[model samples]
Target chain A: MAPTEASERPSLERLLATREIMVACGPGGVGKTTTAAAAGVMAAVKHGGKVLVLTVDPARRLATALGLTGIGNKEHRVPDEAFAEAGLKSRGELWVAMLDTKQSWDDLIARHAPDEATRDEILANPLYQNISGRFIQSHDYIAMERLYEIHSEGRYDLIVVDTPPTRNALDFLDAPERMADFFSSRLLRWLIMPYRSRLVNVATKPFYQIADRILGTEFLGDISEFFILFQTMYDGFVERSRAVGRLLADRRTTFLVVSTLESVPLREAEFFAQELTSRHLHLGAMVMNKVLPEYLRGSEAADAAHTMAEQAGELGGLLSERMGPAHEPLRDSAQVTRVLKEISASFLNFQTVALREAEERDELSVAPEVMVSVPFFDTEIHDLGGLYRLGEQIWE
Target chain B: MNDLLDKKLLFVTGKGGVGKTSVATSLAFLAASRGQRVLLCEVDGKGDVAGLLESPPTAFKEREVSPGLFAMTMDTEEAMKEYLRLNLRVPFAGRIGPVAKAFDFLASAAPGVREILVVGKLCYEVREAHYDLVVVDATASGHIVGLLAAPQAVNSLVKVGLIRNQTDWMLEMLTDPAQTGLVAVCTPEEMPVTETIELAGRVRNETTVNLASVVVNRVLPELFGTQEEEVFETLTRPDVAAELELLVGSDTAPVLEAARLAVTLRRTRSVHLDRLREAIDPSVPLLYLPYLFTRSHGLRTTRQTATSLGEELGY
Candidate 1:
């Protein structure tokens, strides 16, 4: 059989069209959020698919980029005029949602609680309130739940997710399972066993007194009460968390590892790539964002620098003379020459960075994964117009 | 800079990739250069500081990486072990399996317990008379707030305990302006600047952590003044492009492109820097770290940046 058309387009573009869920994950400060937004916009405008971009713990940037009032838990449609101005039209629609971890936690408890009284009790527990509200680990789990909840609704053809800049990005992959494990761990059961069976408590009284001396009697009582209440909903938490984990492992879902070609981020990207493989998650693409443009590579940069320096005096004289004698003070020979020399030096400096970036990209591209290179723009992308420019390059 | 030196602890944080590790290490280097005994602790298991120092990776144990400068990556488990060994003074605090598991459960169950252990360890060092300065390379954004606010969170949750007393000691050191200060790092970009502003506000309102200074990293210098920008605007004309052939001997394309990028970057960067200046508190100092154009962003560049930072701080 002849080669299919899907094999012709770049691997990343094909994945964008085919995959139902695309997760953009990377080390911090690699423009992962913008890349995810741009990809969603691209899929919506080009592939004729309804898309929803989800961002967890964003720095309040996705809203400004999508031209929305705010990026809360609610999904909002990005105005079509913004796309129209960029000379693009979305055949379907584009939606944006930011994960509100607290709301998600409350919703999860409400869904799992056996009764309203139990839900109220869990919500009011000081330990429960602290962990669900303040812990970043809970956000990772809730974000997955929210993703699965929205994906299961089948309201959108594509869902793009931007994860938090975690020190260990793989934590998101394992958080659901870990949360379930913690809930069902023998340690937790043992800690709460006394409350469940009064007979077991009598046997472990010596252990409880020892613990009470270490962690005060009141603290122990508070923890035992908290776990006793939590035990009622233990099966529900484990089952739902496992469902989220299964959703992540679904064939339709894939992860896009994003990073710059800098040494540090490249190392992180490799770690993510390896971790994803080990976890058996589908690798959609590796987006190498902010790869410096290779303006002058190898010996050319040095040759160009030397030639520019040699011609600096002549260029300075001509430009000053062209400006006329009236502006003589403004065209000081020393200053003009300084600017000329500095420009060449700056070019050489940037070329070196670009060259190093290219080498790093080469190292990452050796893997079987699809690598998409995005040139660093001079300006930070913060709006639809910026996203349009970025979207154009993401597909390139 | 001397003002910063007087601080018992300096917590350096920024949006990721804004060079917090390098900034924290450079600050440690500068402090050590000024004859201070400095302990540079990397929190959250981020061991990149050791790599940047061109030294072996620092484990849980502190090692003197440079003259009068020590380094270690804070390990929560190890910190707990140390806390138990030192506080309880039990012979088998680490070896006793049952007791260790109990402490593990206690540490794991609480929300901010790990953070408190890390912050508490930093405070423990600050209190020791041996070290004059301790620099904590904290995680970025919300995590930094979480780390700094750990003491208060634990304090409010546990009304009375050895944990309360430990965190209270940490809180005392952290809340004192002379004892602890925070250096907010950011680049001249929209997200980083906006995040820095939000972080500064949070640090001010939520905790007594002194917002010592804002270090704007990789700032493009003003290569073009108003007159030069006006002059260059004319240069973009087609007429000038043709005249440029006579000005420079053979090729003008490379020079033109580089000059164009310089102008655009300078103008673009200034916009965000202006926003940062307006958003940050005027009383808090703002320092700039110029873009280091070195071939390798390794130790040499870090040392050069440290020198510039030290100079800017008047060390």
Candidate 2:
């Protein structure tokens, strides 16, 4: 849910000191990767412990923001040069990597399988192949294993992860419980049993016999083989998804949800935050990033220019009431500045309404801190230097 | 005079989080100042075009941002939804919620080229010469080729009215160099520039549109003033020390230690810009937008930014 009052909320700082797994999640282009890394870098530099920043999608922006060439599964030390030019002295530093989902799955199987034979058996299966090897975007639970791996590595003080932007942003957050629920469901259990029983007894398997007769094909053989292979991995995947649900719910694990001060995205943010609560994940903060602060118009010189700006815009009267106090109109430029204040106010009001709706979510929420990251400079956080600048704003 | 300008449309695309918006805005500013009636269009669903415009974001049916400058942020879902409702004349818009959701889901989630229809529609807008100049912010790199290749991707998928006609016309427009120019945006960093150049190659192979230009946004101009040692020495001096108190922000450092930061900040940012220049094409003109003291660039600042472009490009 959206945060109702900052007074009532605890905040990210309070949660960060306590929580282990702090997820900075939202939809694409909302600065998820950079925020996670900046916070990771900032937390490390501030608290004197290494912080890991893991990105999912392979975009250059992530690499440049960390001031690195290319990032992969291996956690590389963020070179001193990366933030050196930003002119800040750092204490501890960020350890960065990108999620190699397919490789991660292979590694998980290699580590967890009962034996190499069972591992081989599972990997050979097509269903396993589909989910593990070819799942276009890996499931949340699958990604969680990667998160858990980084968390357990203990090299970093905290693991700041940028989760893959799921087509449905909330789907990644909600999928684990749903996947586990599907696995634990009785109907699925029944469907799998018959499929498993067929693998052991070909003669008595009615569905197999019926399938071969109707299709004149060996589809059931392939299907049974697929299930048999998946049967070994199914319990583990379900168990892992369940543990993720538990880990995400831990009081110390904070979810700092980020969004713009816009209605639709904030609405999505509120819905996603509520989904976390419904699923029992700990809420840390609802951070409204890129907020537009009020611009008040006052000076006599500015007043005359403001009046002129109002004359030009359709919403000038509203500007006169609210956001104004614009730049001193340069000599001979009074006419051009006309109604500019009103246009600025209209945009500011849109932001105000968006932030207010976000504040309303605090009434039903659990996050201790309801913070907003106000809009400021920089078109894109292109490099680590940009992130270094972005990090300063977190404190200021 | 506006009608006399070259009408070549520029389409900018890069991987997500690349400086696509800035580059597209700069290119539009570049064209507009050149006296083209530039209409910068964003179909990325971000309303980024409006964000770049001096005007506030609204319904986005082409509002004027400046003289000879108009901009619009296309809501793909809204545009496509309206298109479907009006053109296809779906019996009931509400009843087709499931179908609409399914179409969007399948379009986004279905593995291949479900994007052609929407892209085909966008292509139609550009093809129609609705504006003398059209600059599109295409989807991120991963889905863009398949998105651009939607027409060929849909030859067998279906045979329909506007979808078919739009797709065919879009293919023609995109393939015509004189009519279209595709520019990939990148930063000076290795990955953005590398992927940008790589994508340029891909564009040439996949389509015949002119690879107009690649604009690298936010490159630092290396300053050539004080040496590192003198900067360090200047930090230690007493009078200069007290003077630094008001600005050098930190918990650990006192006023005296603040000078230590200036050298690093000044030296490093310049090196980055030099690296960016080395990585990008030397011939492609570089437009430097000075780091603004404020973050959310106001209308005034955006105009300043555009004016800086005008001066640099001599538009």
Candidate 3:
């Protein structure tokens, strides 16, 4: 590694400056979507590059956070005025989109089917509707497929992807391969063999009788028919899946594993990092979000405690004066000390959280090159102002 | 807790990162403490329940993580194998590598099939009455509705078959309020609360799973009354330094700053909590869990949370 790369932190600004693609991945509730949106804003405003953020969760969370209404499968540009209000004089634009799994599935079939007849046949199939419409992992496969499709267009300088929740994050990576394998599997091919040969159908009648006893005749026919139609387009689908695999493996694409200060997400991050390494994907940065700021620690903590103890009487007087005769019980010195102590305790709690976050970061020495930390925010971050403020922190 | 414990199956789900694992573990522990045999299951192979219970991770096999409490992770493949062995009576389904591979292909090729196997297995467990209560720590809230509706979706799609019969049985168990309950977990934040509200509506309309309650996790305490908050706000001003000189006879800047930040966090949480309270339907019971300030979310902290939650439920 270059000395510059070795020494410099893996901050969002660096990623925005150079990387074409950034996939924000982490456990659920770690603000992965928020981080991805913030990074997109950072890339557009600070780096003077056009950015696109793609989110895969069915919820319109990114759309809601960006203050955009009704995000569908298509790219919805965040208006210039929203960015202007955020005090960002960006030379580039930011566009956001949510993945529509059903739409993507239809689009994939439209692209890969050998002919209109075959496409219509497959799309009209009941099994195809159930599989393509409700297949849980299809979202994962189609998300990557959409990413590959959008990236090839060269429309945006940077694309930030908000992945599915952590529990299924790896599915997004593996589903494409699994989809391709399922299509090309020998078992499926053999199951559909009778569809191509009348002679084989005649020979397999007894076999069908026994199999129908187990899987039912209607299901057997549905499976065979669905596979026969799907088999016609198998080559096109497999090729696209392999292409998506290559695109994810491209050098320009990077992954930022987002986690929080806690043990569960950090442990999940470690597992994610290992999987990325095993898959030979570029692990760009490890972003630990929601880290509590270290307000008071060690001697400063003691100082706050001492100051609270000294000011207990005056603070009591202040609250007593404010509360008047109705709150006489609250004016006691003992009550005052308890309130002040709570304030100090909150600060100390934050200090402990911050320290623990640092310890968790230290444990991630395996992928120590690009690490960024975002502090926990007190206020809710919604709309352009929040994104801009969060983007500034990400850039920092 | 009694209402939830009474159901043979309880499915707990929430937005990503809303502490569903903790909530599920706490509920299971609470039920087990009430002397009910509780089986806690997690889908998506996260092993969060196992991790929180400080037990070694077990996939597809229920292990006694705590007394009267069992934990298991539902693997789609394992569920598929189990479904075949029990329902189809395929003798070699469990051990044959080719059969497993073919089953994986079938599941992958069909979208809702995997969900059926996993959810069907869960519903099957409930029907079998192996445990007095079964708690499934389902996938995040976003996908949970889809998981719950899978059996019905498959049932409606397939006309007549062994698969249909299996799905029909699972659907029957799922929709019966006496047989199943759905607990939605959330944090007092905009996204999680909004998602939880949406999930509640979906659960009511789409699935037979009863919306038992909403567990709001990681809530901060409201430490400041209106007047105290006003005083705190005034103290944050730089001019308060003059008053500090006379009162404490020293720089109270640290004290004021710490107090202000702490109060701000509480105020933020309170505002969000208000939003959550308003947004959620009043008919639904809202349970709040305080944020634990421990360094790690280990077993002891989890047990402490469970105890507090049990007390709150009056179990």
Q: lDDT for every model?
A: 0.79, 0.56, 0.75
Residue lDDT tens for model 1, B204-299: 887768899899898876766665555555545566645655555445556557668877888888898999999888978888899876666666
- CA lDDT, candidate 2, residue A113: 74
Worst 10 residues of 3 chain A by lDDT: A324-333
Chain A TM-score of each candidate structure, as shown: 0.90, 0.75, 0.86
- How accurate locally is residue B29 in candidate 1, as Cα lDDT from 0 to 100? 84
Better of 2 and 3 by lDDT: 3
Q: For this target, which candidate reaches the highest DockQ against the unseen true structure?
A: 1
TM-score of 2: 0.54
Indicate whether candidate 1 or candidate 3 has the larger DockQ.
1
Task: Give the runs in model 3 whose Cα sits over 4 Å from its true position.
Answer: A1-11, A58-67, A195-211, A306-335, B88-97, B234-255
- lDDT by residue for model 3 (B22-88), tens: 9999888888888989999888767777767888987688889888999888887777666656755
Q: What's model 3's TM-score?
A: 0.90
CA RMSD for every model? 2.8, 12.8, 3.9
